[model samples]
Target: ASRRDAAPTGDFHLPGWLDVPSMAVSRSTSRLRGPGPANVSTSGWTSTMHSLRVGILLGCLAFLCGTAGAGTPLLLAGSTVLYQRVLTQPGAAARATPGTAGGRLITALSRLYVYEREDLAGQAWLRVGTDAAGRNLLGWVPARDTLAWNQQLTLALTNPAGRERLILFRDWDALRSVLDAASPPAAGRALVQGIAAGGTDRRAVALEPETYVNLYERFYLLPILEIKDYSTAAGNPVRAVKVASVTLPEARGRTAPGSALADQGSAAEQLQSFKAAIVFVVDSSLSMGPYIDETRVAITHFYERIRTAGLLDKVAFGLVAFRAESANEATNEQLEYVAQVFAAPTQVLNGEDFLTRIAGLREAPVATDYFDEDPYAGVLAALEQPDWKDRFDARHIVLITDAGALDGTVNAPAGTVPVNNRAVPAVDSSTGLNAAAVQREAQRAGVALAVMHLQTPAARQAGNLARATAQYKDLARNAMTQQEAYFPIADGTRDRLRAALDTYAGDVIAQIERSTRGAATPFGPAARAPAEAPADAADDADQRARIQAIVASLGHAMQLAYLGERRQTAAPEVFEAWISDTDLADPGLRTVEVRVLMTRDQLSDLRDLVAQVIDTAQTDLDGANSTAAFYDRLASIAATFERDPEATGRRRAPELAQRDLLLDYLAGLPYKSDVLDLKKSDWTSWGLQRQADFVDRLRKKVLLYSRYYADTFGWVDIAQTDNPRNREAVYPIPLKDLP
Candidate 1:
């Protein structure tokens, strides 16, 4: 028998056993012809050999089956043991076992599963499953603080057959370490940690928690890893995974049960409903030619802008012109009979008319000439009218002029003082018509006066005329020469006028608006519009322009004051005396009290003046700023009179009083070599003296003029003295006590 042909074929077979067969019978044997008895014997021997091989193979198969059957349980037991060992002591596990012949028997396993989700304490939890090889796995552990008490989450586990089953867990942290290892710290609830098969074989894996458990009052992000598996165990490549983030909104607190006081309107709405008014008192003095023209133009521009911007509809405007005298007197005479009245009685001129008026004034004779300067008279006339209060919602007088008040009597000799028939002996003794009276009247009327001086050659020339041209130049120079000469008295007149205008305009407007709170309202937009569009539009435009010009002029005048350049042309003492005497008694002449609301620039000027005074005092012990000294003089006049009546009543009663205080303060200061060395101590005494003198003069003036000037001035006496001596001096005449 051929060794290749004789092989046993039963339940078991061996690799080198081809000669063993009961399975070697071939259909081709008949064709090969049987050998005779010897051949038959050989064949029989082959058969015998085949049978023997089969028998041996059968015995071997039985033994192998028995061995395998016995070892199967052992293998299963070993596997269980290994699993237990790995489970209990994970580090000692191995990847493969020893073979029956002597080497290791290796097996690969892979696993993949969707982690189970659980809700614990308002947070989501997930438990990940193992891969096919049961090697590496992951789980999700939710933050306990983030979860509510009762919550649930779902997870899916997948097998090699592509089948998935849902799993649920109660605690988020109970998942296996393999699953937990896969989760990041930020991941919620359940986490996954991987498992290793053998100690040597490490399988890297990630387990994704499928669902969140009880997620109340919390936000969640999308799941990160949809699928997870081990690279080496499943023969599959591992892929990167991302975890989803969660966010939640802040909670709101309950409001108090009884709170009901809430604002009904927005801040803007409240502000929008507020009402305001502005009035302009324009100077019609001849000197205000180009300026007045410019003012008108500016006003026109202002009106146009305001109308366009829609502010005109809410604001009201009024106009008053000062320094217009009666037409008859020869020197410092009134230009017209109705001198003090405002240009527009009920309303400001429409644009065209205002411009035309300005042009006419510009073309007309120069009214600010030496013979016609009487700003004081103009101010008084304006305040006297009965309809003044009702003409505009606000009242403001802006005086634009070049010189101070002139003698109202035009034909009087230049040197003679005009007699004041209206003066009361107790109040005023030395003067013709009292110029201070006009100031009192203005104060009574609650008028705020602003002065705008327009510089011109004629105006400046007039100043020289008052000093050199008059026959009583020396007398006038001596009597009136003081800070009064230096101060632009004309400018002061205009300032008084402006003050009146401001007070009247501001107060009146406030009153009107207040009074009209529920009065009949103006017509609505639909009703107010009328036919004649061009004419009406032109008229409205013109009115608005005029108002605008007035506003601008006022602003400019304020700017000039701020610059300390409010005085235009300095007038001579003679001119001021002449004007003061003549115009003081004129019905149009009146005193105006102005409370200046200082601008930044004006404040700066004041500071400079103060600094200059300090410097000057240090350099030359005599106070150089006469204007400041004058105020001091005025303040001390009362004290000097009270202490030394006989001395105060001397030739230069007011003047001597002023000079004495100034000298005393200056003499007390310690001399300094450097101009910069004028410290606060150097000026302290003088400053206090100056302040005292000013207050004293102001009080006396207010008291003396208050009665006669009641129509124009409002009086309220205020004393600012702390020393018992000073207080005693101030007490004799209280401001409010005056009639």
Candidate 2:
């Protein structure tokens, strides 16, 4: 293995396809292949099987337990302690008295169930620990209470013992094994690679469907093992518990981690197995102000784009800024910032937190302007950071700078910046390594580097400009030169800088996707949410629920229409617009989905139409427009949609045709159904529900006109030729000015 022989220098070839045999088999050794073992339940809603997923999540594929008593059911709730229950003795009253000294809530989830096992009632309840009184309690609330986890992952009752309320939870730690050469690829990414060969859907969509829910038409495979209890009526025990050969969930969705019930893999298991981290090394020296400033916009804009697309969780970002004490002057500690201080990589949650951290950060304003900077050290430090070292797959560093490094071997000109006389650490032969050494470290770390040459005019005016160019070019070719990682922005305008960064970001995503192809992370990743305030949690739940409902209703036919261009391809975008408007809580991104997919002219026309529709609907409100008025408006539009598309001919035939179907749904709305019509009552509340519904529906109709052009990573306006428009792919929604 240690022999260093001459390797082939030419590019490698793949014969049209690289086939990887599927690792899962229906054998008794590692897998569970079967119809469920049954005859032990007592309920009306009998259990059934959903084909989602399950397995070894920590060290390897978590195997299905051979025993029937697999796990304990988790407390499904909005807040764990919100509801309280009492562990009444066998002879106690039917209802325990409130505020009783012996009535402490059942708080402890650990060792929760023990008594009756063979026959047990299957129902969801909150299991809390003992209060100061030392008594255990249990509680139940309505199903809407558990909506947060419910929307993303499927939940079910456990087997015989779990039915007896003696199920297991938090088993991931006990089961975690160290990953070696033999572990199977993670289910998230592995499953994605198997579908459409991993190119049709995004890596996030393919891997963790919980976070990247909308990108793919077909959701993640929600593997349901078996249903415990199934009942049609209220107050019935669960109809049935879904069981599987392996510990899978239902067909609707997959779990992020271990909740109460049996083992639903951990978030780290569901997501990280196929994750990537990106580090940006900028020359934050005296002259780097404008570069870093503009790059901030690019980073923030890029983050918002992917976040809306539901793919932000797939990558993490780190920062590194390098500048040695101006030329030979060593007093300025500002310029002596180390590598790790440049910025360690972090997972991209919802916002550009890392970018924000660097926003107010200015370059070290030095006494004398330096034309050269030490990039090699910064690169080496980034590679060594825990973020880079810990990633199982896809590590990348994006180097952005206007200047170059000093080469000791070259007969360098006088007064060049980063003026190290062979004394700088690593660059000096006597005690330190040089740029070549840094380059080797990057390669050794398996990090692909994306270099952007931010050509500044001041740097061009330097006497050693020629030498700087030569050195910059060499540094640019540091690691993975063949991957198109270098982008030299010659014009150097703010627009050019942004474009370069966009192109740079795109390259990083593409390379990661390519490098991780046919491979799976030993474990996958699940997103982590910071602890939120009570009000904030409630608000977020409402907003997310609204979006999810629309996504859920975006039937295969609707998604197909939006994607295939065979019909109204913007139907789903239209649906989301309705969600943003009617949500009880503030939905952060309003019209991003619809706006980015529309052409510039289409966007303008849609805005005008939406404005006009709002104005027209405003006059009919006693309080607000009734559902009847909403239906009438829709009927009118459907009748003469082509005659007055947008009430103007700004739309093309294809777009107008798509708009018609949207009008049809609204026109056909049931005028007086209790659920559909809140006009007769509930006018005392905010904005009046019925009128709000009407307005939101009209907003959807306007957005549906935007003809969504399909692409590899979902849909976009195919006409956007420039990188700015393409990367600004998802813009924030405009606030409506309601009277």
Candidate 3:
């Protein structure tokens, strides 16, 4: 007889939390047991009563399953279920029986629950369905045809428009064989070519080259089912992950591949009229006159070049000037303004107007209290004050500064000066935005902030060059491009600065011209160094190389975004097979970026958790008589914080304790979190200053979370008609953005 879909054999139900619609696979594997007490006698009246109850419940479940639609869950017998979750292999077929005489094809990478297991000879078969709830059933299939996925980890392919096509291998040995070849790149190329040519040897490859997908274009799940970590013969580490592509319900009805917006035009034709804007955010301090003049000359030369190329109207330029800020109103009056926008991005299309606006720009008359200037003010102005979105598709802000930014930290070593040295009290930027916060806003605005740091001798002597370099690099970092648009001048000469600016501007123009002509400019592969070379030096050669690479990447990213938005270019709609997370030829280049699917409630909880930690630490540290006592208090507080929510008053549970979803997910993930797994010993090991720095970093992260919550456009609504804060609506937050 065919097995019936029914509920568990007794009056049993999952906990309230587990009553959620989604079935999350448990990370741990434990032995299954039947319902009722283990020691109950089978022949007793109590046992007979239990058996009768089980039978009645099973009968009711059978009636319900028969009456329900296809999407309803089939609650299987809990005792017989082997695994909580499984994913179908590519081209996997399910049959009515254990043998594959006749079968129906199932969706590859579909999440399923194992209902029953059968073993015959040496092979095993599993009865699987859509979820533990028994929503959709697919009959018995060979064990090898499915993969057990405990963790819900997924990988989304990075944009492949400007890079080589990503390859998927049948197995690890096939991938390793290519890596061990005489010339790995050449061998990989040959393999891809052979696969394209078509023959029996094509079986070595997992999927066709054109099927790789990005999460942004199509919101799908490519779950990482299994992973193998090993070192190559050359001692380089490599990670080989087994991935199964799952197209979510939302991806249905999208325009098929190769036919996106065919009626409008090709992606390139649509991009021919794409607009770009570049703004020069110059520091107007006393020492920046020469640099300011150089900036003007560079823009003048650039405008003439673009005009000659018949692209003057397509590209626009603007300028913003920033000076020092002070707490005293009189001192602020002397400084004139914290930051002033001299020209809107779209205001200056002609060379004459742009030159006229820039020609009168001058340095501040009086020197401020500290060497570090309020560059954040200028960046915010450049980002906020302009109609960048309405006028331009590709927006950029080139910050030309000799000094570091005024950091908000109380005693930060790099961008901060002593409180006593100031003639007037130093004030934060007018917008009250720090570097990281400014970068987030820039990201929200879809504008890239590039920094041209002039490493002058005075800056180096003031011990600000190194600090400023680090700060500027972070400020200019782009998450999409995964590169920093930071160009540092070793000599800090006007000629060098002008040349760098020219090269940077010229590269962008060239990219636009090439992209407009239907040609894609591929960024050069990263340059590898010998084992003895310094790891990450800010050398002039390296900086120039980075500038070129970042410019190219940014240009490519901008073009891709435009095309995706215009053409409605969705990701490929197909179940995928195994694909490598990293590039097969270049293991160092990751083809996939992992992101955490977070919700509004989770972010709010995170903020509250950090705030609570900060408050407890501050209060405990101040009242404790000794460091040991402080640690003791912190340990006790940590215990209280993670304590069971029910143990605490139901109305007043700790915010962190209430964050079950995020906490459980993070615990399962392999990455270490300082906040989640913080220990008393960890706190005790830190010196007083380091401890304070830790608190300060957490405080900043809290502030950033507020900005993220307010960014209404960044979050997506998976359920379009549902409330904005509904659980279905989520933001795929970059892992790096996590506190």
RMSD of each: 49.7, 28.1, 15.0
Winner on lDDT (1 vs 2)? 2
Better of 1 and 2 by TM-score: 2
| Tens-digit lDDT string for candidate 2 (491-545) | 3566666755665565444433432343232211212112121222124343243
* Candidate 2: regions farther than 4 A off: 1-273, 326-330, 334-342, 347-352, 367-370, 409-431, 463-465, 478-484, 510-739
Q: For model 2, what is the C-alpha lDDT against the true structure?
A: 0.33
- lDDT by residue (1-739, candidate 1, tens digit) is 0111111123432222111111101111111111000000000000001111000011111111111221121111212111100000001112111111222111111011212333445443322222212233322322111111010011111110100111111112221222334332212121111111112101211111111111111111111212232232223232222211121211100111232211322222322333323334445654465555555555555445445545444344444454433334562333432133334433443445444443443312444333344444344444443444433323344454544444222333333322331111111111112234433343333233444433345645555334222211111111100101111223233333233233324333333343234232111001111111122212334323333333333222222111111111110010000000011111121111112111122222222333333344333323332333433433333232222222223234345433444232122111111211323344344443333332333333332322221111111111112222211110111122111
Residue 666, candidate 3: C-alpha displacement in angstroms: 6.6
Report how far residue 312 has shifted in candidate 2, in Å: 3.6
Span of 10 residues, lowest total lDDT, candidate 1 = 37-46
- Whole-model lDDT per candidate: 0.26, 0.33, 0.56
All candidates in order of TM-score, best leading: 3, 2, 1
C-alpha RMSD (angstroms) for model 2: 28.1
Give the CA lDDT, 0 to 100, for residue 41 in model 2: 12
Model 3 agreement with the true structure over 310-425: per-residue lDDT tens digits: 88767878889888766566766667776777777677767788877666578977787678888887787677653566667788889999998876544244334322322122
Give candidate 1's whole-model lDDT.
0.26
